[model samples]
Target: MALVAQFLVADRVAVAFAKREMASQIRSGALADLPCDTPPPTVSDVSIGGFPFLTQVLTGSFSDVGMTMTGLPTTGPRIERISAHVRGVHVPIFRLATGGDGTIRIDDMRAAVHMTYADLNAFLRTQPGRVHITPVDGGRRLEITATANLPLLGDQQVGGVTTFAVHDNKVTLVPSEISLSGLFNLTLPLGNLGSYVPQIPIPVGDLPFKLTVTNASTDATGLSLAATATNIEVSTADQKPCRPTGS
Candidate 1:
């Protein structure tokens, strides 16, 4: 029984070491490969899923791997959280054990990013115009208000209700109804507003892990971006870029 216990303890130690090594590699490579303009994101909660990790080591194929990253800076709003999962990760056991150079292949991966309403509001306030977002109908729709500085009107605040739409790797604010606010609110034609209102597009592309934006939605907290990628191959080198299977 004592000998069996020793073996089990050693197995757990090996698993921990392997998971740490994988995470280190990711920190050095994928995180560094992020856009130079933004600070590198911090990674956490890295886990290698499936039991008997040793068996996976022997086969050089992991069933599942997941991690969470935070404070991912983007061109527009900062991403508060990003959780990613990879399936069919292939890396040699010996390579992990010896810290040798080799290529890591991932069959597919999915990732989700989140941004808070407060953060979105902060981002909007920094733009050329003034805009704020409020959730309506339990966050199913958004009430967006923008203050435009017209040539002679000084500043005019207009508001509208909009839903999220994913287009060209951006989350577009598609306003359904527009209204002008004063002592008495007046509903206006959407086309007439034109440049008087701002069309906000939250960019979600160019994130790490080579993932592409698939969809976007909003909730009580903030906006969520769903992304996916397939056939990823990255080198063991910490600073190398992950590429598609062939490229």
Candidate 2:
């Protein structure tokens, strides 16, 4: 268990170092045209697989690495599952630690990402009922609950079983069964009102890696998703002290 924890910690450290380094550059505008509303997004979690960190570092290749970032600030929805199956990751330790200029390339890379319904709400400018997403029915169905109001219906409760698909570098939340309840046990033949939902075509989440969404599911927390990519390029030596422009 201790060994496992250390491996996990090592992976976390690698990502944290990278995030910390790039955050400084982004805030300083060294790397432009990058995603994220503002520079220096938050690195929430990181994990590296195929442990025994020192061996991988010395071997000049890492088997896998993943990270979660928050505060993307993208116009569309932003997914934060920033993970990768990295190969040929060569970094000179002593120089990298000293903030020396170094470059690394992946012979083959498959990066990935996933997001939760809570992450969905965070990206949405105005979410109805502070929308919550959960998985039900043995992961065969998804439940989306929100608040809605109908004319002459007073305040109606809204819940739905929705399924989402990931294509074209985007995730689409499709409603399978939008259940309307909490109307004082009143049933009315409401037509076209439900269709007038304030649904917007927001991307919801954006990711940094060039990955394609592969799978999605719901759990106790919210909707989950995954994506993967290959041969990603990165630089380590560009890291510097994070100082806001004109500060």
Candidate 3:
């Protein structure tokens, strides 16, 4: 019965090998590509009595597996979550828009992005160790680069690149960098606005007024003046406010 025993052991080992290979493929996001006809390999069937020889056969079956093997399916990279923080330094001045009624409106902003540990790990598995991002700027261009250590996998670094443009009130995001090595890019976008706006408090007589002026904006530089005096006609010879005509 030696031949019978050998066949049974071989079959059990084959099944076990298939199972392990299937598990690995699934975890790596590449199980769908595996040949449909080929049953998942299995090792020592724990369901059955101990079979040391069968286990050895199953273990030996997958000793030379590679990532690109044919018939195994591949899964798309997933994004769990993203977070970001922005610290502005030497930010350039910006301009704000004004309404027909002479009211000024400011809306310029800047910030930075960050990724969660789970998302970051998934990204590094599919993409490279570096990334770049481009943000929207009304007729202006901006770009950012992100880099960090790959999470959940190893100490290796990964990143991406993006480019975008800005319009009246919307910022467009552009993806510029994509790595083939990792599964995805985990970089988040962040921004800061205070860096571009200057706060200046103007004291008007006894009333303290605060004026936030953004460089290059018409509204930021415009100020309306109105005066009322009892029994005193107030009219400036020149449109400009007359420096109290000396005495």
Q: Which one is best on TM-score?
A: 1
Candidate 1 local lDDT, 1-247, one digit each (tens): 9987887887798688768766665555456456434445677898998977777766878899998888665778878988889898887657755857787788998998888999888888886557788997767888988875544657777787766778766677666667778744878767755566666777666677677887888888888889988898776655544565665
Model 3, CA-based lDDT: 0.27
lDDT (tens digit, per residue) of candidate 2 on 1-247: 9988988888767655654543333232212235322455565444545655556655545566444555554565565444444444454544554656565554554544445556676664365444555667655666666655666765567677666766676676655555676645443333465463334343633454344566666665555556565665555434344466667
- Give the number of the best model, judged by lDDT: 1
* Runs off by more than 4 Å, candidate 1: 1-6, 35-39, 93-99, 148-155, 192-196, 238-247
Model 1: lDDT to the true structure: 0.75
Which RMSD values do the candidates have, in order?
A: 5.3, 7.4, 34.0
- Report the lDDT tens digits of candidate 3 across residue range 44-124: 212222345344333332222211122211232221111111111110111101111111111221211112223323433
- Model 2 residue runs over 4 Å out of place are 1-59, 63-84, 92-94, 108-114, 121-125, 128-134, 146-158, 180-205, 236-242
> What lDDT, from 0 to 1, does candidate 2 have?
0.53
Per-candidate clashes come to 2, 13, 63
